[model samples]
Target: MSWSIRIGSIAGIRLQLHVTFLFFLAWIALSQGLLTGHAERAL
Candidate 1:
């Protein structure tokens, strides 16, 4: 499966976002939110 997407480009340089990185961020936020019981702090 594809893991990243080329969203756009700037000055002939491609800008892409890796799906796994996003998953990692979400996991961190979710775990932190659960531990602290505060959404703001998780972010």
Candidate 2:
């Protein structure tokens, strides 16, 4: 296999994983903040 093909595949996989991580981080931050606020209100 050509080096270009191998590099391209690696780059594509890295980009995909970077995007997935950003999505999950945003979701977790939002959800945890909301839960903390609710818990504080209940106290």
Candidate 3:
């Protein structure tokens, strides 16, 4: 569907956002921040 599929250009390229991927990225970032002792940065 057009609502879910993107058909456009981002500097001559297309782009899409995946909610699951974003959550995983945030989780990884938070884990790294906590590991280095920056708890505030995690949030």
Index of the highest-TM-score prediction: 1
lDDT, model 3, position 33: 92
Encode model 1's per-residue lDDT on 1-43: one tens digit a residue: 7888889999999999999888899889989898888876776
lDDT of 2 by residue, 1-43 (tens): 3222222345356322345566678777777778788633332
The residue ranges of model 1 lying beyond 4 angstroms of the native Cα positions read: 38-43
| lDDT at residue 26 of model 2 (Cα atoms) | 72
For each candidate, what is the lDDT? 0.88, 0.53, 0.75
Q: Give the TM-score of candidate 3.
A: 0.56
Model 3's alpha-carbon lDDT is: 0.75
- What residue runs in model 3 are displaced by over 4 Å at the alpha carbon? 1-14
**In each prediction, how many residue pairs overlap at the backbone (N, C-alpha, C within less than 3 A)?**
0, 0, 0
Instruction: Please give the lDDT score for candidate 1.
Output: 0.88
Which whole-number lDDT from 0 to 100 does residue 28 have in model 1? Answer: 93
